[model samples]
Target: MMTHPSGLILPESRLSDLMREHPHTIPVFLRHHMVCVGCWMSKFDTVADAVWNYGLDMETFLRELNQSAQSIPPQGTD
Candidate 1:
């Protein structure tokens, strides 16, 4: 798992996979609503950029992302 400086813990799984399963994060993308979060490009993108690009609150966005993590089973558990 890769933890971002902003505290976003990226799973070992690819961004495409994460977004594929967590389509609900769509609302977080304020800009480029059509941009897919789980795409390969997003893998290198940081959570800070995501919020800034989407015009979101860093704290709130982090909270939401962490909350999203709770619903997902930890790696190797599935």
Candidate 2:
């Protein structure tokens, strides 16, 4: 899995992985217009980048991302 000290990068997967595992992340994900969080595009996109797309503060959004990510463990990592 792609590791990030700040959990910025996803857990080595597509955006769909987050969507599939963490339902609570939907609002935040959508807020960033990451409606495709369930698509392959998410894999390539970082949480910080997503927030930038939404024109939000990266640090705050990263907090939200870390919160959301907490619910979804990487595949087979649990």
Candidate 3:
């Protein structure tokens, strides 16, 4: 598990749980071509596991994920 500065999402966070908790971060997953959005493995996988299996650099991926989260405006305030 990686520590995110924003602490909004971390590499150890469960994909399904993250989606449920922070739907706006979906773009990050799509950008990475991740299939966890609709995959059963999401129930058991964490961001770290996905990135590892996908052969992605954890630091870079987490940076993008956090950035995606930061870029999205809060709901009802847009």
Candidate 4:
């Protein structure tokens, strides 16, 4: 399992917790056609489970997610 910079464990991080911590990730889930954004199961499912259920490439998907998270502008800069 990979670890997010915020210390959340990837693959094992509950989708709800992840989304709450990084709302930016919601778009990624949408782009991937993942309904986890609003699904109740998000509270119980982990990122890895989403990947497996969607048949996504783990390495690539995680890389994209990391990239998206990194793109968030530093606070107070505009």
Best by lDDT: 4
- Per-residue lDDT tens digits for candidate 4, residues 1-74, read 23455743477877877776667777999998889998988888888999999999988888776677567632
Tell me the spans in candidate 2 whose CA falls farther than 4 Å from its real position: 5-27, 31-33, 71-78
Compared with the true structure, what per-residue lDDT tens digits does model 3 show for residues 1-78? 322445567778887766665567787888778888888888788988989888999888877877766676433312
Name the 10 consecutive residues with the lowest summed lDDT in model 3. 69-78
Q: What local lDDT score does residue 18 receive in model 3, on the 0 to 100 scale?
A: 68
Candidate 2, residues 9-38, lDDT tens digits: the string is 453433454555455666777776665555
Q: After superposition, how far is residue 61 of candidate 2 from its true place, in Å?
A: 0.7
Q: What is the C-alpha lDDT of each candidate?
A: 0.53, 0.57, 0.73, 0.74
Instruction: State TM-scores per candidate.
Output: 0.53, 0.51, 0.75, 0.78
Q: Which pairs clash inside model 1?
A: 16-38
lDDT of 1 at 59: 75
**Per-residue lDDT for 51 in model 2?**
58
Better of 3 and 4 by lDDT: 4
RMSD of each: 5.4, 4.4, 4.3, 4.7
TM-score winner between 2 and 3, please give it: 3
Model 3 residue 41 CA deviation (Å) reads 1.5
Residue range 9-64, candidate 1, lDDT tens digits = 44333444345445444455533463745456776665655656678676776666
lDDT of 1: 0.53
Distance (Å) between predicted and true CA of 49, model 3?
A: 0.5
Q: Is candidate 1 or candidate 3 better by lDDT?
A: 3
